[model samples]
Target: MVVQTESFVMLSIVLFVLGAMGVLLRRNAIMVFMSIELMLNAANLALVAFARYWGNETGQLFVFFVITVAAAEVAVGLALIVAIFRSKRSINIDELHEMKG
Candidate 1:
């Protein structure tokens, strides 16, 4: 059985909304980062679906670039989070008020 394009888009939207809510509601740095990743993945899903629907590779190509950037972001972001946790002994966003390092 074939899936509908609208259904795919709706699912993608649902995932993106959930991720956005997670980012807005969660206070932990790691949680916020994960939520952002989820949102990015949701966008990728929509892009793939639309690419398939339109019979083109442009969206897919964009997804590849997104994935690459996401990979780099994950590496750099986790490092920063780890460093912050090491120095501050916490990962809560509201607690991180100091900028001088």
Candidate 2:
């Protein structure tokens, strides 16, 4: 059975909203990072759905680039989080804001 693009888009929207809420409501750095990744995945899902619906490769190609950038972001972001956790012994966002040099 062929899946409709609207369904995919709807699911993507739900995921994006959940990610946004997570980002806004979570105080843990790792949780916030995960939420950002979730948002990215949601966007990628929509892009792939649109690409499939339109019979074009452009959206899919864009999604590929986005995924690549997201990977790099994950690497760098995790490294920073680790470093901060090592120095501060905590990963709380509110505490992190107090780290102004």
Q: How well is each residue in 29-100 modelled by candidate 1, as lDDT tens digits?
A: 999999999999999999999999999999999999999999999999999999999999999998987785
Write down the TM-score of every candidate. 0.91, 0.92
The 10-residue segment of model 2 with minimum total lDDT is: 92-101
RMSD in angstroms between candidate 1 and the native structure over all alpha carbons: 2.6
The model with the greatest TM-score is: 2
The deviation in Å at residue 34 for candidate 1 is 0.6
lDDT value, residue 14 of candidate 1: 99
**What is the C-alpha lDDT profile of model 2 across 1-101, one tens digit per residue?**
28899999999999999999999999999999999999999999999999999999999999999999999999999999999999999999888675567
- lDDT (CA) for every model shown? 0.95, 0.95
lDDT of 2 at 33: 95
